[model samples]
Target: MLDWLITNSWLVWLVLFLLLAIIEMMTLDLLFIMMSSGALVALFTALLGWPFWLQVVVFCVVALMMVLFVRPVALRHLRRGPREQATNVERLIGEQALALETVTDHSGMVKIGGDTWTARSSDGTAIPAGARVAVERIEGATAVVYPAAGPGPFPAQ
Candidate 1:
């Protein structure tokens, strides 16, 4: 069987390629598949009457080129994607909510999107209870806010 496989070199290459492809299917990644492509090229060369050493050389060159060049690009393209943003602060940007707790000196707490968040007024003014506030920025777990247009601590007097 070994002598027959040696004499029929193309058959050896084809069988090796099939085995590599099977492994690739089991793994579901691209590394073995790229190497299998190089093996297939060598199989074609052997079928065209190239010497055994020449076929080996072709296989080595092709395999090296795939490993050095194509693999990085394939791995990068097939990598898992980043997750979506899903925090309360992420949802509060550009939204307005009522100040549940008073800000005596530009600091307080507010209920935005049904969640209470530590807050600070953008302008140096006190935010009173029942005042509408707009989210200006997120700092750590806190929300920097600005009082909405209307009567606040400084009523339009």
Candidate 2:
């Protein structure tokens, strides 16, 4: 069986390529897609009557190029997603919390969603406890807030 497979390496390479592509569909992480491309390149080389060693070399070169160059560019785009300005979902945007403790000169604790978080006022004003505040931004784990005045952070809904 082994000897026969070595003789018909193109079939083996083709099956391997197809298996990789199929698995890639399930995984969706993009790593196997690169391997699948190399496998297909190997299959093509084998179909062209190239010896096993040359086919292996071509597969390795193609796989390396795909991994090093193509994958990074693809992943970078995938990681960032469409660059539509900062929204409320990101940290400290569109959040309402109460000042847990007195905020004096830009330092205090604010309670939001049943959790206490370090907070600061952008205008550097001292806020008392039990004050309704609006999250303006976040630095690290801390949330910057301003007193809720006039219309609240969220409009009537």
lDDT of each: 0.79, 0.82
Q: Could you tell me every candidate's TM-score relative to the true structure?
A: 0.52, 0.58
Candidate 2 regions exceeding 4 Å error are 83-137, 140-157
Off by over 4 Å in 1: 1-3, 80-157
Candidate 1 lDDT over residue span 1-157, tens digit each: 8677667989888988998899999997787888888889999999999988888889889988998899889888766333345454565676777888885445798877667888888776888987888888888977888877764332121
**Candidate 1, run of 10 with poorest lDDT:** 148-157
What is the C-alpha RMSD, rounded to one decimal, of candidate 2?
Answer: 6.1
Q: Residue 17 of candidate 1: its Cα lDDT?
A: 90
lDDT of 2 by residue, 1-157 (tens): 9878877999989898999899999999888899999989999899898988899899899988998999999998887755365454463466777887987656899887667789888678988987878888888877888888865444222
Query: What TM-score, to 2 decimals, does candidate 2 have?
Result: 0.58
Give the CA lDDT, 0 to 100, for residue 80 in model 1.
35
